[model samples]
Target: MLDHLRHLLAQDPKLAKVGLTGGLDIWLFRNSLKILEWAGSARDSYNSGNTGLIQRQAVRILDYLDGTQYVQTENIPSDIQPILVDPKIARVALLEVSQSEEPPGYLKHIGNHLREIISSPNVNDSQKKLANEINLAINNVQSWYLGVHDDAAQLIHMSPQQLHQPGTMMTLNHMFKLANNAFVGETDPATNQVKEGVSQIHYEAQRLATFDIMACSNNETSRPCV
Candidate 1:
């Protein structure tokens, strides 16, 4: 069922636009994962004669589907600085399946094709420049997609003291803002506020700098700040 829904959304942007507004896609994707994970638990409860457990789960599902679900955002480090984002992009970012299981390769395939074109010795200067620009754009989008998960994963392994440090907290907030821009298909202000079409290579660079600072602060000789 989850796979079918993902297929439909991937095939039809119009359908996704209508269905995924206001972070409904996030709630739906997460709840679908929960329901799948708990299916066995539900079955066991049914076999144990605790029918109320199934009934309660059904009620919760109904409530969530009807938009009564309350997500507590206070503790989520990545959500510390909330901003508007396109629902469709948000859904893509939170996709749980492996890359091979994704619907189809779009940006990556195009990027590879562009790289070949750019690298060909026969290509004209103008054509090579155009291809380079397109490749740069594709790379930024790919970076945005990867950075969200990578930053969140890093935060997950950090100690509470590390997470709450002044520099780390600032970096988290910056990352959150960058994510909002990525999700909404907006340019990063830090890189492109005055410039028209600068490449967005900010998030990963910021993340590395923050990690280096944190590591140095902890006196970890292995990864001293450069």
Candidate 2:
């Protein structure tokens, strides 16, 4: 079921990028491993009326799908796909599956990983299957994520903090903003008005210089602060 969804995303250009939004999206996306792990764990306990390991997992999947509307790759449930057309709705949907304090920020990392996996030169058919599964999982989260929140047409109103990501210019910009705070430049005597936002920007830039993405994220030791 999950694999089918992954293939759907891999085939569809429009729905593929939904995984980069939030934490819950990642957990449910990564639910691939858990769903499998739990099944394996339950196998030995099924004789005690546990409905068998597969049944237990199926029940769990049903609950998630029934309440959250997450479907497998093979079954492209109509309603959920349409809702996911809007990015914000998708983001909110992902946020729904995530814990408030989820670490590793799964969706963000998985999206990053997926991007690379799709482009790798040595990839084979099996790897592609896994890649697609991950993609579908991402879309499943997006499907639910987009169902009950901001749609694509709305104005985006997010803080800079939430918008943070990698890239040289972005790093430099944050650093500049962190180091510069009090709006520099000369003030006019007659008008008694301020003349600059440079100081404020500079203050932010300085602070950003010490901002270690590794220390901040903890899980990402490779991320540099500069």
Q: Using lDDT as the measure, which candidate wins? A: 1
Per-residue lDDT of candidate 2, residues 1-226 (tens digit): 2322232232222234544432232234334333334334333333343332323343332333222333232232232232222232223222333344222233433454555655666554555655555555444433432331121101012222322323322322332222121113335699986433322222322222131122445456654444
For every model in order, what is the number of clashing pairs? 0, 37
- The residue pairs in collision within model 1 are none
Question: lDDT of model 1 at residue 125?
Answer: 67
Candidate 1 lDDT by residue in tens digits, 56-107: 3333322222222111121323523221223333333222223552322334
Among all windows of 10 consecutive residues in model 2, the one with the lowest summed lDDT is 148-157
lDDT of 1: 0.38
Model 2 TM-score on a 0 to 1 scale: 0.23
Off by over 4 Å in 1: 1-99, 105-136, 184-226
TM-score of each: 0.31, 0.23
